[model samples]
Target: MSTVIELAPGVRAGFTGRDGGVSREPYATLNLGGHVGDDPEAVAENRRRAARGFGLDPRDVVWMNQVHGADAVTVTGSGPAGDVDAVVTTVPGLALAVLVADCLPVLVADAEAGVVGAAHSGRPGMAAGVVASLVAEMERHGARPERCAALLGPVVCGRCYEVPEELQEEVARSVPEARCTTDAGTPGVDIRAGVTAQLKRLGVTNVTHDARCTRESTDLFSYRRDATTGRFAGYIWKA
Candidate 1:
């Protein structure tokens, strides 16, 4: 069975790990990212398995062409939801997925409203307010931010995600919660923390997280730790 993290009721949202897949090393096992040089067939099969984990067909899941920006799109059917970093949908059985390695994959849902969303929040995406944009898109679909719950998936932690001082400062300017010092006492950013803060700022108070740092966890795929590695996914759908 595929490992899944529990979220709120009436909705299914979870993250996939680097297991139960058919790819070889580097992209070993469950690599869901098609743009990461993994064999297309292997990636396809991995995605199929992921969908099955949620009791949905592979063709019913909508994946995004993430560009590390704040673009959010509403998914109306099963297919690619254009070049956006986040996708929200109210359609039952239509799962929305976001791919990530070191970056954060955020899943949000308002079970009562039957609206669900998934976002890819990297340094650039967070600084650009991707989470807030996602909540707004969810609201457009009748989801209330106050009633929404968010889940932050596995990602590189602040201690492991060292960045240049200037870049860190640039991101921190917009997301003050992102500012931090690395384990080595150099500059870094805890994007998950920032994302959580952003979610609350947008009135999404119920939030959960997978504290597993991708760079530190062998079960996860981290691009910063392994540049040639594959990517995992965060998925959300209404039951």
Candidate 2:
């Protein structure tokens, strides 16, 4: 079964794991990132497979160029949304995707308004407000946060996301809910907690989360666990 959540009527959102693709080892079999040194042809084919698996045409999905920033881009067509961490769309049937390894992938939708958005929230992006930008964009299209169904996909949990005290403090200063103590008693950042708090603060009431930690799950890709690794994707679409 897919890990994708059915956010609302006619709207579906999900995250992918490493299982089916053509990229060589490290990125072997199912790596979807085109800029991660994976074979371009292999990545293209993998993307097509992912799209088809979701009942969407390869050309019907909009991918993003995420730089761990807070930029949110709106889309009405199936093309790359450049240098953005989030992508929002009001067009039914158009899918928005965000690639992540250890970072959190957020998918949200208001099916009644035909608005859906996906965001890539890493420690920096979370502190910078990527999810907030997505919600604002969705709101512009008539989707209220109170009516949106949201899902936070697999992420590097705090227990495995140890960081320097300074770095952790920096992130926590911007998003207090993200700070945590690792299992080893080191400083950590809870990307999922920070994002969930952000969603709640935005008034999004129906938030759900996939409890899997990318760093801990062998099935999912994790850059923290494997520096050079494949990237899985999170997808959102309206039917």
Candidate 3:
């Protein structure tokens, strides 16, 4: 069975590990993203299995093009939502999914409002305010930030994500909490920390983070660690 993380009652939210599917080595077993050059059939079957983990049909899940921007679209149906990094929904049984490697996959839910959202927050998306936009979209669907709880999924931690000084400075300008140093003392951005701060600023205080770093954990996919590899998913849905 696929490993699942429970977030709230009437809401299912969790990250997928890299296992239990039909893809080959690089995309190897359980690659849920179609854009990563994995066989379309393998990706489809993987998705079907993922949905089954939550007791829903594969068609019940909604995915996005994930352009690494701040667009959070409200989805009512299960299909591609175009070039957006985030998706939100109040529809029960319809899952919202975000594909990620080193980037953070954020899941949010206001169970009482029957709304949930998922976002792909990479360096660019974080700078573009993806998490904040997601919160706003959730609110638009009647989800109050103070009542909403967020899950910051596994990602490349600051200690492993080395970047140039200028890029770090640029992102940190808008998200100060993102500024950090790598293990080798090089500049880096702690995206999960920054996202957590942003969520709190938006009034989403009930936040939980999966502290495991994708780059450091073989259980998760990491683009920085394996450039030609698969992408895992973070999914959220209301019961």
Report the number of clashing residue pairs per model: 0, 2, 0
The residue-by-residue lDDT of candidate 1 on 126-210, one tens digit each, is 9999998999999997999899888898889999989999999899899999998989999999999899999988999999988
Clashing pairs in 3: none
Residue 72 lDDT (model 3) = 82
Worst 10 residues of 2 by lDDT: 1-10
- The global C-alpha lDDT for each of the candidates, from Candidate 1 onward, is 0.89, 0.89, 0.89
Cand. 1 TM to true fold:
0.97
Q: Candidate 2 — which residues are off by over 4 angstroms?
A: 1-4
lDDT by residue (1-239, candidate 3, tens digit) is 33566687788777788888889989888888898889998999998987887677888889899898998889889888889998888888898888999999999999888889999999999999999899999999899999988899899999999999999999999999999999999999999989999999999999998899999999888889989999998888887
How many clashes would you count in candidate 2? 2
Candidate 2 clashing pairs, residues 3+ apart or interchain = 4-14, 21-30
Q: What value of lDDT does candidate 3 attain over all alpha carbons?
A: 0.89
